[model samples]
Target: MIDGALFVVVLVGALVCAVSAGALYAFSSFVMKGLTALPPAQGIAAMQAINRAAPGPAFMVAFLGGALLSAVIAVFTLVSWPGEGGPLLLVGCALYLFGMLGISAVAHFPRNDALDKVDPEAPASAAYWRDWAREWTRWNHIRTAAALAAATLFVLALVR
Candidate 1:
C-alpha cells in the first residue's frame, strides 16, 4: 500500500514537473521574445500584467503543488531508502523543489517585483525592461531545464 501510494505520488510529481517545464519553456522560447519586441512601455505593461496574474489558482496548483509533492517524495525516500528508486526520488524532488522553485524565489521574483515598482512608460523603465527580459529569460531557461530534468528522473524512478 505504501509502495502504491509512493508510485502514485511519483507519477503525479513527474506530470507536474513536465507541466512546469512546458510553461517555463513557453516563456524562454517565445513569450519573452514576443513581449520584448513591443515598445518598452507596452512590453513592460504586458509583463507587469503577466506578473500580476501569475499568482492565481492554476499556476499556484502546479508551482506550489509540485513543491509540496516533491517534499513528500523526499521524505518518503529518506524514510524508506529503497534499493533502486530511492536515489532517483530524492534527486528528482531536490531538483524540482530547489532548482525550479528555489531559483524562481531567489532570482525571478525579485526582478518581477522590481519591474512592478517602475513606471512602464518611463525612460529608465525602458532600459530596465530590456535588461529584465534578457536576464529573466536566461534564468527561466535554467528553470525549464530543472523541471524537465526532474520529470525525467521521476519517470526513471517509476520504471525502476
Candidate 2:
C-alpha cells in the first residue's frame, strides 16, 4: 500500500544501510582480527591510516547517505502516517540514525581521535592499542547489527 516514491526511497535506504553494515561486519568479522594480530605498533599505525582514509566520499556517501535518507523517510512517514509500513519505516530510520550513526559518533570517533594522538611505536601505544582495538571492534559489532537490523526493517516495510 505504500506509494511508489516512498517505496523507492526505502529501497535505496535499505541498500545503503546494508552497505554500511557490510563494511562494519568486515571489520568485526576479520579486519580487526587481522589488524590486531599485527605487532601493536603496526596495528596502531594501520588503524590510524584506515581512520584517515575512511572519511572520503565513497564511504561517506553510503554511511551518511543512509542517515540522510532515513531522516527523509522518517519525516515523510510521520507526516503521511501511511498504514502498517509507517511504524516499520520509523523504527528502521531510528535504528539507522541512532544505532548506527549515533554509535559511530559517540563511540568510534572518540576512540579514533585518541588513537590518532598515540605514538604508534611507543610502549604506551601498545597498551592503548590492545584496549582500543578490542573496544572499537566490540562497538563495531553493535553498529553492524544495528545497520543490518535497520536494513531488514526497511525490507519488511517495503513488503508490508
Candidate 3:
C-alpha cells in the first residue's frame, strides 16, 4: 500500500501541478490570444501589469512553490519508489521540473525580466513587445503541454 502521508503528498502535488497547468492553459488559450488582438503597446501594457502582479505571493506559491513541491515529489519517489507510481512520478518529475519549471525559469523569466527593464513607451518597446509576447507565448505553449502531461501522469500515479 502506498503510505498515506506520501499519497497525500502526491495528491497535493498533483493538485498544485493542476493549478500550474491551468494557468498555462489559460495563457495558451485566451490570454495570449486576447493580447494579440490589442495594439502592441496596449498589449505590452496589459502584459506588464500581468507580469508585475504575477510575482506576488499567491502566484509565487503556485509558481515557485509547485516547482519546489514537485522536486520533493521527485526525491521522495526516488527514495520510496512505489510500484506502479514510481515510473509515472519520475516522468512527472522530468516534465514538471525540467520541462515546465525549467523552461519558465530559464527562458520565460529572463525574457520577462528584460521586458520589465525596458520602457514600454519608447519606440523600441514596440518591437520588443511584439518579440517578447510572441516568444513568451510560444514558450508558454511548451509549459502548458508539459504541465498537462505531468498532471495526467500524477493522476495515474495517485491511482496506482
Candidate 4:
C-alpha cells in the first residue's frame, strides 16, 4: 500500500513539474519578448500587472505542490532504495525542490518584488524596467531549464 501510494505521488509530481516547465517556458519564449517590445511605460505597466496577477491559487498549487510532492517522493524512495526507483526519485527531488523552487525563492521572486516597488511611470522606473526585464528574463531562462530538467527526471523515475 505504501509503494502504491508512492507511485501515485511520483506520477503527480512528474505532472506538476511538467506543468511548471511549461509556465516557465512561456515566460521565456514569448511573454518577455512581448513585454519588452511595448513602450517603456506600457511595458512596465503590463509587467507589473502580470507580476501581480501571477500569484493566484492555480500557480501556487503547481509550484508549491510540486515541491511538496517531490519531498515525499524522495523520502519514499529512500526507504525503498536500490530495490525500487531510488536514484531516479532522489534526483527528481533535488531538481524540482532545489533547482526549481530554490531558484525561484532566491532569484526570481526578489526581482519581482523590486519591480513592484518602482513606479512604472517614473523616469527612473523606465531604466528600472529595462534592467529588470533583462535580469528577470535571464533568471527565468534558468528557471525554465531547471523545471524542464525536473520534469524529465520525475518522469524517468516513474519509468524506472
Per-residue lDDT of 137 in model 2: 91
Error (Å) of candidate 2 at residue 3 is 2.4
Task: Give the distance in Å from residue 151's predicted Cα in candidate 3 to where it truly belongs.
Answer: 1.3
Q: Rate the local accuracy (lDDT) of all candidates.
A: 0.90, 0.93, 0.83, 0.83
lDDT of 3 by residue, 21-70 (tens): 89889998999889878887788888878999998987778777668878
Clashing pairs in 4: none
Each candidate structure's TM-score, on Cα atoms with residue i matched to residue i, is 0.96, 0.98, 0.92, 0.93
After best superposition, candidate 4 residue 84: deviation in angstroms?
2.8
Q: Give candidate 2's root-mean-square deviation (CA, Å).
A: 0.8
Models ranked on TM-score: 2, 1, 4, 3
Worst 10 residues of 4 by lDDT: 80-89
- Clashing pairs counted in every model: 0, 0, 0, 0
lDDT of model number 4: 0.83
**Runs with alpha carbons beyond 4 Å of true place in candidate 4:** 1-3
**lDDT for residue 136 in candidate 2, whole number 0-100:** 96
For model 3 the local lDDT of residue 49 reads 85
Identify the candidate with maximal TM-score.
2
Quote the lDDT for 51 in model 3: 90
The C-alpha local distance difference test score for the whole of candidate 3 amounts to: 0.83
